[model samples]
Target chain A: MADAKPETKPKKTHQERMARKKQVIDERIAKATEERGVLILLKGNGKGKSSSAFGTMARCVGHGQKAAVIQFIKGRTETGEFKLFKDHPQIDWHVMGHGFTWETQDKTQDIAAAEKAWAQAEQLLQDDSLDMLVFDEMAYMFKYRYLELEPVLKALQNRPKNQHVIITGRVMPEGLLEIADTISDIRDERHAFRLGVKAQAGIEF
Target chain B: MADAKPETKPKKTHQERMARKKQVIDERIAKATEERGVLILLKGNGKGKSSSAFGTMARCVGHGQKAAVIQFIKGRTETGEFKLFKDHPQIDWHVMGHGFTWETQDKTQDIAAAEKAWAQAEQLLQDDSLDMLVFDEMAYMFKYRYLELEPVLKALQNRPKNQHVIITGRVMPEGLLEIADTISDIRDERHAFRLGVKAQAGIEF
Candidate 1:
């Protein structure tokens, strides 16, 4: 056979190179779906921590996953999240309207509300059927010393292995940090309020 | 005598009236200035959209506002956001990286890089001098197919009405939403090769 001369290879154009890169990326994505056991914490002074949590709840619902939420200090008013998820069959949503201690000032009532909220949280933590749980502003409970960290930690550790959890607040307790698989703190460097502005609907609130 | 009779009124405990109300609803801490225009957008799918946008190089150094960020995308990675802000002099921090993005093709790489860094994000977005801007995954982007929408319309039309702008993407591209805004898209999503599953970092470049 005639010597198979080495054929020169053609160089990939930028577009072609990008396409190849995308294909390879897609392949790797296929492999990442297998891993499990994830926890998330979103803390910050900026807006949207709770919004993000609710967004996750919506995603869980899309996936046909059973999800639950316990609002530690924002139960008083009707939140957009409550309106959206409360009626959804996939989510078990609960809110503790006690608000924050700085605003509430009554230590005794704060403790009582924390106890009541924690009782509901305990049940959610025990339910293996739940694919995800969100503790909205639960950090305030620990920050205010309204709830014992030990029990919360125990509940987190004891929850079903497959269940994922999310906690949102401005203050993150060290104990929660130690237990959290993921922690996000939101820092507010420049906020609109300093300029004497008001919070707009759907943006801040 | 009439004043004495009027004095015999019933006393109310502090908790009774406040019980039905929120101790603290959303409160605006500051306002935006005419010289600055900062707005934040937070909403769906893509990871680090908000983090990356707030990781502006110029603003973090210029302003001394105590900037911060709370990431919704969970998973650890040497985020661009971290390289600039984590140890910087004028920044505060927080993070929640618990391996989100439910549809993963490569589990190991995905989990390893799940924690989206927000160091730089805090430095720039939170600075009082820098003004406030948060890309809390502002939902308008995604709802509009990265091109068009209504929610974003209202956001742009009625933000705190001023200086800083932070936008996170998930398909929001309302009619010239960036009409008077600075806009940057993270562009990269669904990465697997970046983690060396195939594409690897730098080369997946």
Candidate 2:
């Protein structure tokens, strides 16, 4: 026991620890072999929520799966994503063209725009043929009470079992986390904007 | 004062508070209007770090900016992303094709593979023509001591001023965060595998 060099850690311990960790992870991976649609929620104050949702959309498209996106807000911004997927056959993309709620300013108009977008989303949700749907900033609709949560939740519940739905926003609704199979809370610990770093066209838009 | 109801907050107070918040945000946004390529670090235990990086790459490509990806660890698996970008003219991608370290079980081979990949990455890093570069899972190389960190860090420090770099992985090195303009700590609040959900071909890869 006296000869043991406990103070100076050895490499073998690291390997052993990693091996054990890998074993547990491998088991979990093995157990996670079920194939089905998953509800993914990206919430909190972070830069990458919409980026993540769009990334997954690309992933879905990469697999040749049918995918659609309904932007609940900022629908008029000419994002690079719109240009990339605009002509792609595998993607069904829609933007409200009304811009942001604050910019629109009219409550009645905002409600109508949200309703129009929701109708498109409801169709996608109910379609058994579609593989994936992205509800971009849908959480804000529910948060602002522009649209009721029950109908959207009900649509999600009634969606085809194999259709994946991804919702991105800050401060998700009350019961969304419980229903989501994968949830990431992206905490913006450091933001360049706060430090006078501007949002680039390709990066931030 | 006598007519004021203490139980009901004044609407003007609410408007004034919101106006103050908006002013702060607007100031930050205005101050952030300066344009420069950022060094972004996505760290923590979450599912979408690499996906977010790739999404950025796609966004860059969407804007017609030249970009590249050097996947350090997960190079073998034919990701849906690879298929999507293989023929993309604006994007240059390289994968080790060496798979994971545990699977190879050869330190020399792993080091060699990492070095080969790093060489390509260095070329990209030094290329001013490339608007963006992604070192996918590059943090692992530093953590595992596969490649010397000093040289890589030097390359990053000396890279083109207008070039953007994004590094994705868990538990980044000490000095990395200081160099990063934006950092998102993606917390894995919930994972589907915990509930016996599996990684699908298009979804997980």
Per lDDT, the best of the predicted structures is 2
TM-score of chain B of 2: 0.89
List TM-score per model, in order. Answer: 0.53, 0.91
- The regions of model 2 sitting more than 4 angstroms off are A1-23, B1-24
Chain B TM-score, one value per candidate, order as shown:
0.41, 0.89
Largest DockQ belongs to which candidate? 2
lDDT of 1 by residue, B102-194 (tens): 323343443343222333443444344534454444343244233234543555455443335555656545454454333323222233223
- The number of clashing residue pairs in model 2 is 2
Shift in Å, residue A201, candidate 2: 1.2
Check candidate 2 and list the clashing pairs. A32-B198, A198-B32
TM-score of chain A of 2: 0.90
- Give the DockQ (2 decimals) of all models: 0.05, 0.53
| Model 2 lDDT tens row, A86-186 | 78898888986375554555667778989999999988998988899989898898887888988888889889999999999898997787689999988
